[model samples]
Target: MTKRQQLEMDRGQDGSDSVHPLHNVSSDRSLTVYPRGDGQLVVETETLGHLTPRRTHGTDEGRTDAKLPDRPSVHGLSPDLLVPQPATLEPLDQHIRSHTGYPDIIYQATLIPPANFAMVAPFVYRSSFPLKKNFPFLLKLGIKSILTLILEDYPVQNVKFLRENGIRLFQFGVPGNKEPFVDIPQDMIAAALATLLDRRNHPILIHCNKGKHRTGCLVGCLRRLQHWSLTAIFEEYRTFSAPKSRHMDQQFIELFNMAHVGPLIDTNHLPPWPTLL
Candidate 1:
């Protein structure tokens, strides 16, 4: 065929001329083909645009090589493709421990008669020993005295911390067991109530090991002094002492004579209950 006819036949429908059949076309570059006596086409590709080499600056030297960002293997693909990266998820216990620093002590604690009580209510609070790390939380409450129902001696460090913070301690040992027939003594309960009644120890904290049983009994008696119904007092006790509530403690709270404790700080003149910030 004549060169002109061959060229016309090779031209695409869009009127753009195509290279010889043996040559390949590129999206961004032009292709040229030359026929040889062997009937094979020699192909040459030319880039469509001019590219300027990028220049970089260096701190020590005058000039530096251009640095390019790392690219993924499969253009447009993520670099982490097929790579088994470790998970960065935190465990549930670890998350809680990060905040509390004490994983074992998960019991909830709050001010007695809750903050919802009227402002005239006494400023009494209850919780487990303000263990070293938790002392700051207790200190912020401005507690003046601590009433411990624990039978064992107080932790020396806790006592020292209380003294350093100008907090007096009153201990009335009640056996820390759940024996159904075991009862809290009336005299001890009376004395504890008397201490609670005195305005000198206005902001008091009563606690046992877990702040459940012994503390519940003492608070139950105080609730009795406040003329709270047996149902209300028991409900409050059961709330703190949950799944492991002691029947004997409830029985003691029910049978305990409010007359033994005598008159307490009149409900009308009590200080406002403190709250957590």
Candidate 2:
């Protein structure tokens, strides 16, 4: 016989076998097997009646029945009771009065401003990186294309994201940096301008690593195409790129002649300049 059948025979040994071995156990109690199987042991619990104290009538006439408090229901409990409240901004502002070195601006991830950002025309914006994190902001601006001037390899993830979002990329890879003063190539400038002037590529972004030099040069050339005075163009460039802004960049913009690029459109007849201008 199996071990279970032997256990049953052992339990029925009394011959007055109408009653089970555990039949005398109370209704509100139970037997539970822990660490189940070969080495398992049974645990008996006395619940409700055995756990609660029974009052004797004579001595406990005026006494209240002592019982455990009911557990609070999670479904109806207020969230405030379970979690500590977050600090308020009003307190930070108040603390700023006494705290000398406290920061006035809080930096947030994915919320940093795009480097040297500016709008050159209704459909043309200029900046650095044009990161995937800033893609949502670009989408909000209705930008349809990107004109990248970085000499390095473009990020594959950014390329994939742009393709998925239906944004086109127009790259003009220019080597070297601002310190050594590499000149912006005429061919690259001509190609970028051609892309910019094309209505289908409207709402485009032009960017270099810092958007201060190469991008400034391209936008300055666009200003020349619009017949903007040299002073006005330089002033706009200076506004976007300050302190470390290069004089070579200004010279490049001043010498750029739009007549050589191709036929020019009248500024008044072309779409309005970017609102950010």
Candidate 3:
């Protein structure tokens, strides 16, 4: 076929002359594909989206952009725990002896964090339900308490782990926010906020089924109490519970009576968060 005809066939009905990349070319990476045989020699280029970091909405326009830290503050936690330690294949005793003249004293293990884990404050963390595999990572965080928003009974394994580790469990047990009729309880959320505000509950982990809706609602309210703007609060809520965010939850946050939370907070035991209102 002639070059013009072949080019027309390649461009097809769209009529735009932009050439599609070769099958092997990735849109995200910088790679040049040299032509094979008599094929046209065209260099593949990365898209602008891949080269430049896309700024999140509301970051500009006079709104202060709150970015998540690369490493969140783990107050009172061992610095070593912040960075996961690599497991060594060498025998424990041999490795320990070689390093510090000790025998069988050091055991290296990989820490697997729970799904969707992220720090909400200095010592408060949010995530999906914890499992047996995530126990080591939780332990490393020095978590003293856990707050669960699901209405179901706690898992046996999780209960045992908390009992053995002396980690307190506070279950608020709110129903999921469903459409048409179901709604989250405002009082229960207020109570959970009181629990979160207590300094004694430092290093607490909050979770519900997927750590999205119910958990996001609770965190959204917490942000409100911290005096965050509605735009920032909604942005944070969507950050964790995107693609299926419940408008009901955002409405709940918007209309929530901070007065309910105020009476519940003990003046003497409040956390030292500077932003708390």
Relative to the true structure, how large is the alpha-carbon lDDT of every model? 0.63, 0.65, 0.76
Give the backbone clash total of model 2: 2
Summarize candidate 2's per-residue lDDT along 86-124 as a digit string, tens digits: 342245444443333444443223454477777776777
lDDT tens digits by residue: candidate 3, 233-252: 99999988989988888998
lDDT of model 2, residue 127: 90
Q: Give the CA lDDT, 0 to 100, for residue 268 in model 1.
A: 51
Of candidates 3 and 2, the better by lDDT: 3
Candidate 3 runs further than 4 Å off: 1-107, 275-277
Which tens-of-lDDT digit does each residue in 2-108 have in candidate 1? 65555566665436543433332335556443443332333444565633222222331111222223434543323333221235236655544553456454644
- Number of the predicted model whose lDDT against the real structure is largest: 3
lDDT for 203 (candidate 3): 90
Per-residue lDDT of 235 in model 1: 93
- Ranked by TM-score from best down, the candidates are 3, 2, 1
Cα distance off (Å), candidate 3, residue 172: 0.3
Against the true structure, candidate 1 has what lDDT? 0.63
Return the top candidate by TM-score: 3
